[model samples]
Target chain A: MSETTILRTEQLKKSYEKGKYILNNFTFSIQKGEVVVIVGPSGCGKSTFLRCLNLLEPIDSGSIYLEEQLISAKDKNASKIREKIGMVFQSYDLFPHKTILDNLLLAPVKVQKRNKKEVEQEAEELNKKKIELDLEFRKEEFLSKTTIWWPETKGCNR
Target chain B: MRDMGISVLFQGNNFVRLLIGLLASLRIAAIAMALSVVFGVLVGMMMRSKHGWIRFLCRCYLEVVRIMPQLVLLFLVYFGAAKHLGIDMSGEVAAILVFTFWGAAEMGDLVRSSLISIPKHQYDSGYALGLTKWQVTVHIIIPQTVKRLLPSGVNLLTRMIKTTSLVVLIGVVEVVKVGKQIIDASRYTVPTSALWVYGAIFLLYFIICYPFSKLATSLERHRKEESV
Candidate 1:
């Protein structure tokens, strides 16, 4: 893999039980600015593989590298690594209890410890784009705001 | 001032004694309910643990509390412990301990079910934002859980208050015990005083328990409408 490969997993092995390998020797790498989709039949380890990429699932045998840094190590800081890799779900469910602005502000302000005023001001620019996007979108929460907020997060746009 | 047995209820300090006894019952129930919420939330969170031993321990605790009656738990803590372990604990303390054990178990189950009622993706969404486990729990998960859990908690408090009547058997000077004392004292002069005093005790319990149930139902309705 080239140095620009942001996420790489080598010889990945995972199983729910011994000798029943769901993911066996799955070596894959994605380069920067590449949008690659992995499609397969159900229970073909697609979701599990995606989960393992973000450290949500642990690999039984193999290694995961994010920008050539070993993030799959047991002792590495998971939150720090996960901050650099954002995963959106199929449902697009934002925190329903919070307002749209609060949902956008949560990671940047709380996780990154950034200045609220600066973050709010930065987000205001996105709000204009969001308004334009909303004109074509259905009036549903799942699709409306979360799509706009996705770009504000780092590494997600990569 | 008629010599009938009904007058035996409100005569002099007899009324004061009933009020004091009711306060004692409320005190114990309130304390136990508070402790239950604190410990119950902890147990509920722990029930979702991935470790085998922790989940096993939580399951065993819940089953034991379910199979064994709350009164039996009280006796084990109060009389049995005093007899065998020489703990010499007081009735109120024992009642609090037993009630908290039972209440926490019930409340923990309530919390667990309410937690599961939320969609599974919310946790994944929070964690994917690079928020720590505790951050997602405290900031994202628990606020929603508390909003859903409150009505059931208020309902549980009323049940706890009614069950506090059981503590009188352990020799606590609760409302019913004092009512029994009043009836026994007037037994000779007013032979039918047991009916009046016991009736008065029932009225006191009704007055305390009814409003709580009304509030719970109203809150429950609001919760249902909002959840949609």
Candidate 2:
């Protein structure tokens, strides 16, 4: 229960029926910048645990806190809590109608209310990085060219 | 001489009647398809709702539409509902209403399945991004649903074009009705013309439907190759 805790869950539980529990007495906490993974067997509820963390699934009983803000399982504001924790899927899940740049910029513009200019700058930087990575993958000699595009645009660096 | 003969046939009174009838049916089918797609997506989303009552209501709608034949449903709306409600409906209007009802139910099922086909991880990933439910739905869930649903919707559109012929039974003049008219007028003098007329009808349908089939398949293939 330190002041710097980014997420905390207490006694989180979920059950399909009254006497059976898929998750019972689950509790965990993670500080900001912490990288955590929950691994288990096929039906072991790792995904379910992630769903609970994101409040995508309703917990039968529990409380979750993000940055000192409490998230109710049934709260109308659950959506706001969802925006802070970006989760990359095993599948890329990129929008087909959108190009790669649009997919990356969608949440930032729509959810975070960031300006389109700022978002596009970030997108271009990411694209340049991707190109650099591709070049590196093909041959290591182009490592020097990685910073060639560096600082080409102000405020592009995340 | 052959071209002159064809132009003369085309300019005949019977040909004009057939042309008008076919256009009317196409108009009705197009409007109905548009309305049905909008209604269907909303209903389909509701069908997959977390709320039990919403899901039940949508399920009941699907069952009712499925159990009743499309022709019967058309008749009920055209004859029964119009009479009971004391509303005046033209044959074309009645056809649109009935087709829309049927289309909505069918489209809703397609949409629901498409929505479901989206990997569960997509939604979780959307949520992980701290997107609100509406944001996730609009930005993530719906876009994914569209990619999955478009192929099936195209298939449904092709079927709808063929189904528009059923409107002829309701006294709506469509391609088939016009073909029947040609056959009726020419049967005594030139019975062989019936086969050609029907063949023409098949060609017209193929022209309308073939592109949609190709589009559906290609889009599905492209989507498969795309990132999830």
Candidate 3:
């Protein structure tokens, strides 16, 4: 209930079959700038938990909050809440027909209704950063500590 | 009185006719394939959607497509819909509509399977990296699916090309129809010419489809090796 809570889930639960609770009464909260890892055994509901956070999986019962607004547990406004959250899969699910640059620019262009030139510029910037990170990795001393960091900075919201 | 030796392929007339027919078929297939690909990919994406009604609708469409044969689909498109529309569509237009529908269904399924087959971890990692769902689909899912789906798409394209011959049944002046015309005209001296004409048709089909088949198989094999 803190003012800085970026995400909050209360009594979250999911079940694939009737009465078979894979995730049960999971209550958790994430602060605005914190990174929380949900580690569990194989076949546990870690992935489901992530999906539920974004409404990718409908919660069987309970509710989730993003910022000051309620995300799930409501029928009408779920999609609107989902717009604020972004998800990426473990696999490099880049579109084959489209180039790497196009992949980066798609959501921004289509969903965000951003200018093509701006999106293209951002993609180019990311590409440059990736190259720099790679070069840093090759250096003898800096290789150990080099990190590319997030692809996009938070404040650059367009 | 002696009968004049009238060779059927006097000079180069037959080749010109066949060439034109081949080009027309190619044009029709190309346009149909392009439109179908666009439609199929969109449908495929919808099928993989999380919403209940969307998924159900897509599944229903796929099942219907699977149950109905493509030839029947062509008949419905040419005879049924064309008549109802009262536009008096050309046979070629009817052929395009039939194949486009068929290709869209098949390609949609291809795209859906490819999209679903991607590992969950991929989506998670993309999320962990803070990319949006749309971003992940466009970036991570679609690229991998394209690599997987290209060969099958090419295969579909070839099938579409071969199937264009069915348009002949509806009176399209394709290679087969022209060949049939030649056979009917030269019913006397063209004894066994049907064999040659059909053989030529098969060769033309092979010429169009062979490279695509090779590309599909080779790309598939290459993907496997790369994965391994």
TM-score of each: 0.88, 0.76, 0.67
Tens-digit lDDT track of model 1 for B1-228: 458888898788998999999999999999999999999998887887788899789889999999998889999999998999999999999999998999898898888888888887788878888899899988898989988888899999999999999998899999999999998898888889999998998999999999999988988898788769
Every candidate's chain B TM-score: 0.94, 0.87, 0.91
Q: Can you give the DockQ of every candidate in the order shown? A: 0.72, 0.48, 0.16
Ranking by DockQ: 1, 2, 3
- Please report the candidate that would top DockQ against the real structure: 1
Model 1 chain A, poorest ten-residue lDDT window? A149-158
Q: Residues A1-158, candidate 2: write the lDDT tens digits.
A: 88889888889888767968888988888887675667667777776777777677788998888787778557457657666654444444555566656766666778778898986886677556766466644653222222222222111001
Candidate 2, TM-score vs. the true structure? 0.76
Question: Predicted candidate 2: interface RMSD?
Answer: 2.3
Number of the top-ranking candidate, with lDDT as the measure? 1
| lDDT of candidate 3 over A13-83, digit per residue (tens) | 89989898888998888899886666777678776777787676778998887785677855635444544
Q: What share of the true interface contacts does each candidate keep?
A: 0.73, 0.71, 0.15
Model 3, B39-135: lDDT tens digits are 9999888887889899898888878877987778777777886578766778889888878887888899999898878877666545544556676
The residue-level lDDT of candidate 2 at A109 comes to: 78
Better of 1 and 3 by lDDT: 1
* Cα distance off (Å), candidate 3, residue B202: 1.9
Once fitted onto the true fold, the runs of candidate 1 whose alpha carbons sit more than 4 angstroms away are: A1-3, A17-22, A134-141, A152-158, B1-5
Candidate 1 RMSD to the correct structure: 3.0
Model 1: fnat (fraction of native contacts): 0.73
